[model samples]
Target: MAARRKAPAARARRRSAALAVGLGVAPAAVVVLLAACLPSTPPQAAEPAGPPLPPVSSRWAVAPPPAVAVAGANPSRAAAVDLVDGAWADEVAAATGIPRRAVIAYAAADLTVAHEQPSCDIAWNTLAGIGWVESRHGSYGGATLTKRGLVAPRILGPRLTGDGVAAIEDTDGGALDGDDQWDRAVGPLQFIPETWHRWGADGDADGVRDPNNIDDAALAAARYLCRSGPLGTERAWRDAVFTYNPLTRYINDVATRANEYAQRVELG
Candidate 1:
């Protein structure tokens, strides 16, 4: 991206005309005055942004999460389904201090449910990867998830109005994003209002469905990925991620970060 500025030439021209009209100055003199006022040559243009860098390795991404974090839910269930790598989440959290609650969510999303879709193998790290990209495990913008897994000061993305983002019209009647004119991606996982309405889930097995909840969003994301067929092969992974968001950079970032989280957590 380049920083754009208003050219001084236009302003100079306006001043030149006023000066020429106010005083009976010669046209040549006015021209000379304007020339003196304006730049000899155009200002140097701002440099364009560089091309998107390829993933450092298909297995890992390089960015670190934001340093500050809002307090999150306790996530200590009295009767919870055990994750395949249940202890791994606690291990990573103890090792890295990234919040055991979030680590548990990732592990559960990865291993707990088949999500009613047998073909897909949604990795916990992949969910963690998307979390890293989306809302930093619901700790974005100095906000945090409530103990119920609901995003407290719910995250809302910039309006998608076909400007540079998608051209999705409002689907929910301002129920989720409070925007009836246009659609906004809501919550840490960033689901557009309409999509959330259709796919809103209750991963915590709670009675109500809320897109703002990390458990619900994660399970919903898993369901979405599973809809794209099997995720066992690389092609399957690409297809599933493409279905989620159709940008090469997005998919690559997700894949890279997911793998990195996977590697780190799997250490235990």
Candidate 2:
């Protein structure tokens, strides 16, 4: 789940901008100067701003409780993901700082997992925690998530060239990450090429197991977490999250966010 750090490139670009400023160029003129170097794409719709994310802290001693009560699964629902009540999703999305569309996907994914693997006890907020950490619910890098749960200008993590990440050579041959030299994490849940191959799912029943689609990615992440075994207890929950990403900070971050979402939903 970890990828190359973006700080280095960001720092390098800042230094370059400073040098241009020293060369008798106004700071505002840098944008015009760098126009040719920037990606040329259609203007994206503005992403909604939510409350600031709560700071990371340990909640691993206890797993977060469910955000809402789910009546198991409904066979009359068109899809497993439709188990989430729409009105409840809207309220929780606003209270928890997740986009509405993302709330639907995350809640639906958890519901789907509940139907398929109820023993896992995966909660929607836990999936929301991962979604926030992974790609801000598919709104990272100025990208926009459409009503259909499709993220435009697809989210891609830095290439895993071993600088500070695992040195993975190209596995998808540019098919998913568009890089033949090395593999990069893809989608909102940040699944690597190999992991996506193993756990990808079609949450929206669109017939395509696309990682770029939030519905698909969220379900894939749910299934991946469920595969780690039952999360009915604290240790099991921590182990499942750590298995998703080994870093202690990552586990804490997810726990903190998930807990906050649960609290927010309760208050709402």
Error of 1 at 163 (Å): 2.3
Candidate 2 C-alpha lDDT tens digits along 72-166: 44523567556565666667777777898888887777666666776676767777777777777787788878988988988887666766555
Report the lDDT of model 2 for residue 214: 88
Worst-scoring 10-residue span by lDDT in model 2? 10-19
Which candidate's lDDT is highest? 2
Instruction: Score residue 143 of candidate 2 by CA lDDT.
Output: 82
> Residue pairs in steric clash, candidate 2?
none
What is candidate 1's local distance difference test score?
Answer: 0.50
Model 2 ranges with Cα > 4 A deviation: 1-77
TM-score of 1: 0.66
Model 2 superposed RMSD (Cα): 15.3
